[model samples]
Target: MSTPSYALRDSMTMLRRNLKHARRYPSMTISIVAMPILMMLLFVYVLGGALGSGIGLPNGADDRSGYINYLAPGIILMAATSGAVATAVSVCTDMTEGIINRFRTMPISRGSVLTGHVVGSVVQTMVSLTLVIAVALAIGFRPHATPLDWIAAIGLLALLTFALTWLAAAMGLVARTVESASNAPMPLTFLPFLGSAFVPPESMPAGIRWFAEYQPFTPINETVRGLLTGTPIGNSGLAALAWCVGLALAGYGWARIAFRRHAKR
Candidate 1:
């Protein structure tokens, strides 16, 4: 039998276990899954008009797509970020309750545990994101880009979500409790609001504008929006990729190290 084959086998096995857990806690799963849906409705229908008008987007939009397009990426980010919190809490609980300890004694590969959960969280976040997009359709939001644009937009957001899941895994392993674990993603979650997530960062106060300008989320948000709208990335896509790759590597390194240390201990 090939050795690398065993790794794939172990990953699948671990994934099955995680899916079972998700099935058992429908409420936890739904809460994790539905946040994007709820927020999309709340922000797009209820708040989009006033919010869009305030943005000074042109007096007559070619269509009523202003805020929903702006809000779509933010909702996607919010959806992905919210699901990551569940990842932390789930891992923290396993660690605290010694479920992870029990798993360690089993025959599974060590990375399988965290890696499995990361995959599940990414899949879950994507589901939430799909719901948000569906709601966007109902609200009459249309992408200016072609089919390729939709593909790229989804692909970029999915990559970003995976990167975030790895970082969230680090929090899950090291945090002492559920609350602490969930807190790790909070700062990143708040990052978008400061950037062009809701309103354009240029409209902010001078001090706030300075902070939003260089913050990593600005480029990422701009990159996602550009994909949806067919707007040019204008030199920022490279910066966005650098941020995503950097954070992903850092988070994965920290999380991997933490997992190994915990197993040894």
Candidate 2:
């Protein structure tokens, strides 16, 4: 087999290993899926009424149903980010536990180790997304999207997941311990809250409003909200695409460098 074939095979093997580990210890995946769902329930049931009134929903539909349509996209974005911690922790565990040194002695592809982590994380994130969306629907979040809109929304989410998982993998590579790795991505999990996730950026004060408007997750959330809820995407689609691509490249480069630096020790 050629080099690329070997890399692909090794990556697949690593992905299987990661998935098996996730299955054996289901706590991480369950937490990743649970946080978003619980947040959705909290917002929809607890604060949906008051927050709904302020979001400027059409036809004065500022109730639980109306609020859910606006809130579901952001919660879904959170779900994507929630998987990052798992990726980081898993990678760091392998690093600290000396499995990486064992892999170094084998003939497997060098990049496959990281590739497996990334691919497995993306797979796990997508599953979490599915569950979140299901719960959103169950909770009266109605979207006016067409088939194409659904496709585009899901694609954008997958791209965001891919980008974040790579960044998390890099964080894991650089962290000295599993606990630190888990904490490293905490800001990412909460970043959507600073954006237009829960409320419009227009409602925020001066400084935070500006940040809520320009932040990466803001545009991404807007694009997803527009696609799913028919909220007029404007230029958000382009911005979201740009951010995803840029982040993916940056994370990939960072992870490779960190891996090489660690391999030297």
Candidate 3:
């Protein structure tokens, strides 16, 4: 076969492998749906009433449902974050199973194997995000922004997931054992809690406040929130995109180097 045809075949083959991996344990898909629902319910009905005043706005500026406005974006970020949890474990599983070593012998692009996994994860994560949004709407979450901003926010969420998934890929590559891979995502998962996702950064401690205000997740959370609430957020949207793209490049670069070197060995 010609070189181009071989590469195309390899990417498609890897994509299918990723899809198969996603189905290997059906409970993974179930947990993805269930966890976000639990978080949305817990935040909306339970903590929301107690913390409603902290959000400082009704659902749609004048619409009494403001809590949903505040809670919805937070849920989206958290939902996106939840999707990265299993990445490390899955990556480690590939290494453990000797499949990656098998791939090393093939003439395919080494990067495509990792890219395919990320592609599959992104698709699965978006599906989870869609379900979470539906539950939020059924519970009274509404976006005040025009359809454009709504689309932009979802686009941003996908970008956020896209980049973060690469970081997860890097962790999977560098981690020494399957167990460490399981623990790798914990730090990334904890990040949203330090941001405006759950509460306004101004409400946090000065030390924590400084961190939250400047962190990448804050802009991501704000951009999405501003979109949902029709609030004015200016350059921060660009700032968030920059962060996502930057991380994606850095993570993918390192992971590609590692995979290439590992394959050569």
Candidate 4:
């Protein structure tokens, strides 16, 4: 009989293994962190003034500082997404390389193997998020969030990371190749751009505006902005929470089913 304590112990051991693998091949982590940072620099330095003015900021025509505040949350959201690809790739690599089959022959909890990948990916995502936020703070982004607000914002990001990591795990399991896994989560990384990440939904065209208003990232971005920058969340908070919970549950179910099917095969 597998006890909860034994499962936790097994999961932790698997977590250490995944962490070691990450340390051995750090190019993925570097790329994941570098992309958002580059995007931040591009938007803040190159296009900030024009975009800021387009958004109707008071001094946006001349100053890029105001745009940084608006763009910071989205970039952080990007940081959350950037790791999904890495997670999917790593999970798929393990599956294709026959390690998952080897694990099946071991005397460990079945769920612990996936748990390790999910938890390790979440940790990596949070670390990347911290780096992005640090860069944001260094580069003229100023958030006026209170302590509680900061806590809520971090919690939301963690929840988002957890949800996405699980989904990526499922994608990894379903993917037939490592290359396919790498590409599967590309849409997730770009979802924020189509939403209100860079501009308000009002600025987009009719069809895009509808999508930007209704997509999951827009509300999540809005809730983060409200928490960090004092923007009005209104009903977006509830919507964001709903989306996070729904995705997390769906992803968990999907990953479990995929893992079982693969185990049987």
Candidate 5:
């Protein structure tokens, strides 16, 4: 068989292994999925009225529906980040186990192990995002995007998921234990809150507003919001694409190096 064919087969084998783990130990994935949904409900119902009123909605302050429209994009991004954490934990588990050492002794493609975790995590993230979106719709989150807009939104999400999954894989590779791996990706999940996820960055204090606007999550959030609501995306879409590509490349390199170092240790 060709080198590429061998790599593909090995990668698929690892992918199936990861999927089986996800199927058997679904509690972790379910917990990750539940966090974003719970947050959406809390923000939309508990705090939506006060926050919606302040965002200059035409429907006035009582419009939780309008708030949902504004909040859904950010929440979706949050869900993606949250789901990526699972990849970190899964990778960490594999790394600490005897199976990883066994694989290193095999003739299969070395990269396939990480690829499998990344691909499986991206798939899980998409599923979690879908569930979150369904809940958003049920809560009256109306988006005015066209078909192209929807495509763009999904594309951006896929890019974000790919980038984050790679980063999580790197984090997992570096961690000595699953506990550290699980905690390492916690910041990714919390990053959206520091950005414009739950509220407009403009409403924040000056220092926070600057950080919020400058952060990677903010551009991605803005791009999603623009795609979904027909708002002007400006350079945010470009910025988001750049961040995703850059992070994916960086993370891939880092994960490869870390895995090699870990194997040698």
Candidate 6:
């Protein structure tokens, strides 16, 4: 086989291995998926009224359905981040185990190992995102988006998933243990709260509002929300794409460096 063929075969093997691991230990993925759903239910049922009123819902009235529609995009992003955290923990575990050393001694492509984790994580993220969206739809989260808007939203999500999964893989490489790896991605999970995920950034205090408006998550959130609700996306879509691409490149470089250093040690 050619070099490319060999790499593809090796990567596919690793991808299957990772997928099997996910199947055997489904708890992590389940927990990741559950968090977003629970948060959605909590906010929509419990806090929706107050938050809707505070945000001044469309037509100048509080409505849970309106809030649900606004909140679904953020929760979907949360699901993606949570899945990334799962990737970090899984990668950390693989690094700590003897299997990675064994693979290094074999003829398999080195980069395939990282590729497997990233691809698997992205798949898992997509599943979680789908489930969250299904739940949102079931709960009266109606979107006014056209088919083109849906395509754009999915594309944006795929990009975000790729970037975040790679970053999580880097985090895994940097962590000495699975516990640390698990914790490393926690801040990402919390980032949505600080962005325009649930409430308008303008409603926040001056300092907080500045951070919310300027942060990467805010633009991404806004873009997704706009795509779903027929709101004008303006420059947010471009900003979100830029952030995803930049982070992906940075994380890919970092992961490669970390892996090389680990191999040397």
Using alpha carbons, what is the TM-score of model 4? 0.97
N/CA/C clash count, model 6: 0
Error of 6 at 99 (Å): 1.3
lDDT of 6 by residue, 1-265 (tens): 9999999999999999999999999999899999999999999999998898788755333777678878998998888788878989999998998678999999999999999999998998898899999999999888889999999998898888899899999999989999999999898898999998899888999999999999889999999989998667799989999998998898899999999999998
lDDT of 1 by residue, 1-265 (tens): 5767877788888778777888887676688657667877877778787878777653243223677777777776676667778788878888899988888778777788887888988887788788777777787766677888778778877888888888988999999888899787788766787888777777899999999989888888788878876656787788888888988899899998998888788
lDDT by residue (tens digit), candidate 2, 50-163: 888867776455887788988999999999899999999999999999999999999999999999999999999999999999999988988889999999999999999999
Off by over 4 Å in 4: 58-62
Candidate 1 local Cα displacement, residue 94, angstroms: 1.6
Clashing pairs in model 6, backbone N/Cα/C closer than 3 A: none
- Cα RMSD (Å) between model 2 and the true structure? 0.8
Two-way TM-score contest, 3 vs 6, winner: 6
Off by over 4 Å in 2: none
Instruction: Give model 3 RMSD, 1 decimal.
Output: 2.1
RMSD of each: 2.0, 0.8, 2.1, 1.5, 1.3, 1.1
Angstrom error of the Cα, residue 49, model 3: value is 0.8
Per-residue alpha-carbon lDDT of candidate 5 for residues 213-239, written as tens digits (9 for 90 to 100): 999999999999999987788999899
Best by TM-score: 2
Clashes of each: 0, 0, 3, 0, 1, 0
Q: Ten-residue segment with the worst summed lDDT in candidate 6?
A: 56-65
Please provide, for model 3 over 178-240, each residue's C-alpha lDDT reduced to its tens digit, 9 standing for 90 to 100: 889878887776688898887788888899999999988888888898888776679879998
| Model 3 error, position 55 (Å) | 5.0
